[model samples]
Target: MSTKRDIIEQLEKNYLFAVIRGKSFQDAFEIAKASYEGGIKNIEVTFTTPNADKTIEKLSEYFGDTDMVIGAGTVIDDITARIAILAGANFIVSPNFSPSVSEICNRYTIPYLPGCGTVTEIANAMATGVEIAKIFPGGILGAGFIKDVHGPIPNIELMPSGGVNLENMDTWVNNGAWAVGIGSALTKDITSDDYTSVTTIAQKFSDKLKEIRSNN
Candidate 1:
């Protein structure tokens, strides 16, 4: 089993979270496999999918056997959080912070990346042992918001989601983002039945992240 610290270190080192929302299990699995090949170790399966649990299960069974790690995204409550963990989710991510969700993740000893917009929410989430807090719809806040909040609490780790792409990826990492969650920019090719494109995009993001990490 991978320890919490191990997963945390991997996230910090990789600096990229491949956010995936599959319409079906096969689609999700294919996308995940492509991502793994492209060097994305962290994958987030959103709950809104038709059979998200099963998708996570399949992913965990396949990717968990290797160095890759899986997480549950769009997790709304404690019930869903527990379900995802039992199904083999190594981490939990929510669009917004929830006390119940955080508590459940704590019980499992898994990392939680709950969304927080304001300083107060971030502080509250930090109190619950959340090492990283996600800024949803990151385009709205942009890099300025991250610099502003991080200026005060330099220790707080942040990940931006909802508008991240290859073009602006550097801005987020340069601004001190522990990682960035990429969605359509990484998986949009799946729609055209062109899975190879997924791998190409994933590799591009991974390479870019590594380049910035090296420079910094």
Candidate 2:
């Protein structure tokens, strides 16, 4: 198995991971490209959409040669993980901690970000031999909560998702969040009428992240 640092390094290569959850695969593809062009090299396509496997396969085929790292989100169990992996997902993300899902990802040598909201859950995820955990509902927990949690488990890599925007991105990063998972804030304004809007938003967010990194 690859070391946790190895996975962290891989994730760090692409600071932004776009979360795409909607009804249209075509729209998702366009949104993905917009993000990719705007400097985000990672994308997470959720499984709740229709023909998600097909969407993953299409994205894998389309961006196979690029440096972009495409992954699957909302992965629940081992079966979904296997399907996503087969469809060419580079990683798996879940909304809640699932050892079975992590084990499958580990078996396949793929990185998994298991969702954890509490100290016990974070410890449990680390106990499974997976060091990266996603702090879900980041809006509710806030950056202060993350800082408090890391006081004891500084070794744990916590990626906060949900309610993350350009405004508070730096706060999370500065407060011990290894990375952040951003959704609607980055894609909501993007409509089929104009694709440039998507790329513009992505670039703005990327620029903000860079500014934050520099200041920190």
Q: TM per model?
A: 0.94, 0.93
> Candidate 1, which ten residues in sequence have the lowest lDDT sum?
186-195
Tens digits of lDDT, candidate 1, 106-207:
888888999988989999999888889999779888977789898898888899998888888888878878888988888766656668988998999888
| Model 2, TM vs. native | 0.93
Which prediction has the highest TM-score against the true structure? 1
lDDT of each: 0.86, 0.83
Q: Which stretches of candidate 2 lie over 4 Å from their true place?
A: 1-7
Find the candidate with the highest lDDT and give its number: 1
Residue-level lDDT for 200 in candidate 2 = 89
**Candidate 1: Cα lDDT at 214:** 94
What's the true lDDT of residue 40 in model 2? 79
Q: Residue 129 deviation, candidate 1, in Å?
A: 2.0
